[model samples]
Target: MEIIKTAIDGVVIIKPRIFTDSRGYFFESFSQREFDEKVRPIQFVQDNESKSSYGVMRGLHYQKMPYTQSKLVRCVRGRVLDVAVDIRRGSPTFGRHVAAELSEDNHLQLFIPRGFAHGFAVLSDEAVFQYKCDNFYEPQSEGGIQLIDDTLGIDWRIPTDHAILSEKDIKRTKLADTPLDFDYNEDLYKK
Candidate 1:
């Protein structure tokens, strides 16, 4: 596997080696040892999957400190535009975002650390998205920034009329109004 760093401090893109034959293709999606050597030592405790139709947009979401999560995400079927936004206070790239096309075709995975907000938009007719999180879900700790917040200026790669969003997501606070618990501590990335 090859890991590519993004402009943000802790976000990265991982490309796995694929072996192809007459029948099909094969790749090691995840290996504990390889992951630890390439990325930080994050003990993923929960795995989640979601299937969505085209135009579906989810996120700009993160959890508060003490329940913050680090994730390894990818699209296993169809395609999606995965996005991560830096929300750590005092960070150089705070509020900046990295958009990656994760799909079955490219087989790329994104590593999103705890201090960022993450979300994705389905680009294909349908998609199966999966992610591994180091922390368990905490309903009370959930928080998010509006996906369409003008300050962020994200290009979801889909037309506004075609985008489908949850009512809760449409009503999320803007980044400037959201309360973030993370500070730009260099040591935070050392882990």
Candidate 2:
């Protein structure tokens, strides 16, 4: 696997070396040894999967301190525009974002570290998304920024009228108004 760093400090794109033959295609999707050496060491505790249709937008979400999560995500059945936003208050890249397209053909994975907000938008008719999280989810610690916040300049790749969102997502506050708990100087990876 090749670990490609993104504009932000810890976010990255992982491309697997795939082999194809008469039978089919094969690739090692995840290897703990390689991941630890290539990227930062992390013990992903939970795996989550979700299925969504075109224009479905899920987040710009993160968890508060003590329950914050880092995620390795990929799209298996279709395509999606995955986004990560830096929300650390005093960081140089704060309020900035990185967007990548993940799909079945590419087999690319995005690693989003603890202090960022993560989200995705389905671009195909249907998409099956999966991710490994470093921390177990705590609903009480959930926090998010409005996906449509103009200041963030995120292009979700879905038309406003065509996008579908949950009531919870629709009610999220803008980045400036959101109560962020992560600190730029804190070492989020510390155990």
Q: Write the per-residue lDDT of candidate 2 for residues 1-191, one digit (tens) a residue.
A: 99999999899999999999999999999999999999988999999999999999999889999899999999999999999999998999999999999999999999999999999999999999999999999999999989999999988889999999999999999999998888899998787
Q: What TM-score against the true fold does each predicted structure earn? A: 0.96, 0.99
Cand. 1 TM to true fold: 0.96
Give per-residue CA lDDT, model 1, range 16-56, as digits (tens): 99999999999999999999998877789999999999999
Model 2 / residue 99 / CA error / Å: 0.3
Q: Any runs in candidate 2 off by more than 4 Å, and if so which?
A: none
In model 2, pairs of residues that clash are: none
